[model samples]
Target chain A: MELQFKSELTISESGFLFDHSTGLTYTLNSTGQFIFRKIQDKQNAMHILNFVMQEFDVSEETAHKDLDDFVRQLKEFDLVSR
Target chain B: MTEKKAYSKPTIIRHSVGVQNKFGRPPATVPINRLDGFEVSELAEKYGSPLFVLSVKALRDRYRDLKRAFSTRYPNFQIAYSYKTNYLKSVCSILKQEGAWAEVVSGFEYDIARNIEVPGNQIVFNGPYKSHEELTRAFNDGAIVNLDNYDEMQVVEKVASELGKTLEVGIRINMDLNDPPWHKFGFNVEAGHAFEAVKRAEAGGKLKVVGLHIHTGTYVDDVTIYSRAAQGLVNFYSYIQEQLGVKLKYWDLGGGYASHNTLHGAYLPAEQTCPTFDQYAEAICPILMSGPFQAQDAPKLFIEPGRAIIDEPFSLITSVVSQKRLPSGQRGVLLDSGMNIMSSVQWYRYNFQSAQDSGTMLEDTIVYGGLCMNIDVLQASSSIPPVRRGDLLVIPHVGAYNISQSWQFIYLRPAIIAIEDGEVYVIKKAETRDYVQGFEDVPGKFITN
Candidate 1:
């Protein structure tokens, strides 16, 4: 099954995201917002991880952990399916 | 090439108005940042916001000041910290290190004191209501139980008779000291209730009267009020000794000392409004010494000070969640903390500071908590500098009663960090969703496979 980014994701200019499906709103920093946007663009987990690694100056292990934690949060809120 | 680029450059616009300082010198620069040479914003970035920070130096200094004041005045003075103020293990451990005995009002607090290894004799059990089991445990542990009323006196006597042991007890007496009277707890002196309780205890011969306890009220500003209270207790002590031939071992002036937190309607801050420990000792020592009872026969002085010793050293460091302009042209700054956690805000005009220098003038503003409830306001109308979202706000003088009284309503309580020796250590970790749900029982019938 192909997973598509839900239109319920509302993003403000200041990197605040409000998911209508789940009534939780989160304020993310610029870098966090960038990663979230990339994930929402129907990119695979590996592709999103690579993009984050290329964009930010961080170790591959750290990037993987951060992305995994972010995805786990989305999964917990039912914002994305594994 | 035909169309020449016409560029409109970005320009800085400054708003100016002809204004004078109507309410005195322009409100002093509201320090909207940094505390104890540490950036609050940086701390919030590393640890989450709504953080509690304790300064070991401030705590030590306040303790030292109180110790120096009482130790110099009376030859035998013992300070028992009221554990109900802030019973966080870290706080209690610090006080224990400073040679403070534990003054507990409940069995739970007594257990905490024992857990921290506070000597049984050092624990003074006080309060109006105590269960039979709690009394028996306290008595067996050799705690000095301060009996409040005649019913408690009978209960203690009955328990002592049953165990065939004479329990060491004290009677809390309420005396009219020319100040506002505290009628809720303790026996009344003028009404002869205290004398009656003492007489009954002496006649029963099962309970030994070892001390006399009195607490006037909290946030008392006048030193003379303490002196008056001491005088009243002295008069009673003299009467009891002369009539009943029993000498009290200690006189407990119960906890009511005010910390340097600004009161709700005080014109000056608490630092200026409340009397220092030295001043309080000066007022009380003379009255204690001037009585007919000398040091050898006079009861040892006991003070159960809670708020004054602990309030100034701790603070709540919260992040500014959002900022908005009210329809009435007032500014509102929302923070990550609320009255649920910072309960003292309901009675105190909490001082808020920024972590760093913003160099902005003060304006009338209201601060709100993260809760959606309108009643969760931290400050009603405060003169503060213009703040933007993400600015760090520091609420000082929150060490007393905040943690003990904090409730878990909406969001989880944040981590409490104790800053000692220029390093930050998490004394209490923030609560998580799993921690909150750990107590609930999910039955198999309610679960779907």
Candidate 2:
């Protein structure tokens, strides 16, 4: 799976995301921002979960659990593609 | 290391330029997670999605507040609970326990009043569609029927003659107060229909005209309309008394009290625009007290308070079923409830809130009900935080017409529970598919097909 959006999209340092294709805007939380950047940097699901596990002091099992739910949500919101 | 962070669904919302930003109004993201110490999420889980949760506290408080607002100002007054607005047995029982007369508008509602054991004398039947049998029962049982038309006046007389008793009844009066006269339901006060109707009742001898009733319209926001409507009724009251030499026993300013629910396409929230109980009281009490009735002969001021007493108490808790992306790239969440059960959604832009906060990022969202119809949209457009399937949403101010008018269409209506001080009372059990189909019969031809 990979994070996908139109090439004209813009993500500010403060986590303000703009979908240039649809002209919609969104603000991401700290975790959302980190995940989005990692996705944009072509990180896989395991890599993203590892990063979350390391930074958020969560067990690998919890990180994997949350990452699956979070990615499913990203797919629902059209922020990523399977 | 720091603690693990919470999760919020990834969301995108269309940012539009509007005058709303210039007004600096309060943001619409109000979190209503718990009610009467019960978590809304748990309520949906326990009672299935699309649950209607009514608050016994809010109902009692509103009844107390409205009664206090009027009774403290005037001596002769009664708050009749309008049965058509919300005739949930427990809802009506609460008001009746608080000393309210049941004001019904149909034979069905009249029967409901009777089934609840409210005495015929304590019921005020006020509708245009009373059947002959219903009229006979009302006349025989001594229920006050507000005569809606001249034909109804004849029906009352016939019933009274059959019962061999002179029946006391109220005449339904309608007048133009800048708004269109609802001409179909009652005798027009301006066109002398009301006056002539009274004379006929007087000459007919079997009917005793006892009250002047006027229900101008519903969701009446302007407080002055009550004064204007009351003044019209009072003038007509004086005219009837002077010409026919009969004094009215009551002056019923019928129901249509506006609650704080913002209408769709409305510029301001209804709380800011809707008149308060005090405002309505201030407008009409002085006039009713000073109206043509002599100080010694003042009639009991009757108001069928329905929406005003019931609307604030209930909240509909529906769960998000699925999320679909709209053409505008906004999330359209389909909830487990829709316009079929939530008829008020077809009229007002109901306040929908997340059961719990997800993020500070408010997005444009469209809320739809679980119905398979195209017209089942709840809130066509609103700003709200992220929500996903199986999450909870709460819609408030639905205790009025929504329940009474709801019919089982495609889906069965949900359970309705009344909460009081952390206690739950099941006012209505959730409808089931078997229950919906139980009354239906398959014709022979249809069964063969």
The fnat scores of all predictions, in order, read: 0.00, 0.19
Task: Write the residue-wise lDDT of candidate 1 on B4-42 in tens digits.
Answer: 222111111112245433432335355746666677877
lDDT of 1: 0.79
lDDT of each: 0.79, 0.81
Using alpha carbons, what is the TM-score of model 2? 0.89
TM-score leader: 2
What are the runs in model 2 whose C-alpha is more than 4 Å off?
A1-13, A16-26, A35-82, B1-4, B12-14, B21-25, B28-30, B442-449
Candidate 1 chain B: worst-modelled 10 consecutive residues by lDDT = B6-15
Clash counts per candidate, in order, are 8, 0
- Per-candidate TM-scores read 0.79, 0.89
Query: What is the C-alpha RMSD, rounded to one decimal, of candidate 1?
Result: 12.6
Q: Which runs of model 1 end up more than 4 angstroms from their true locations?
A: A1-82, B1-33, B177-180, B447-449
The chain A TM-scores for the candidates, taken one by one, are: 0.82, 0.83
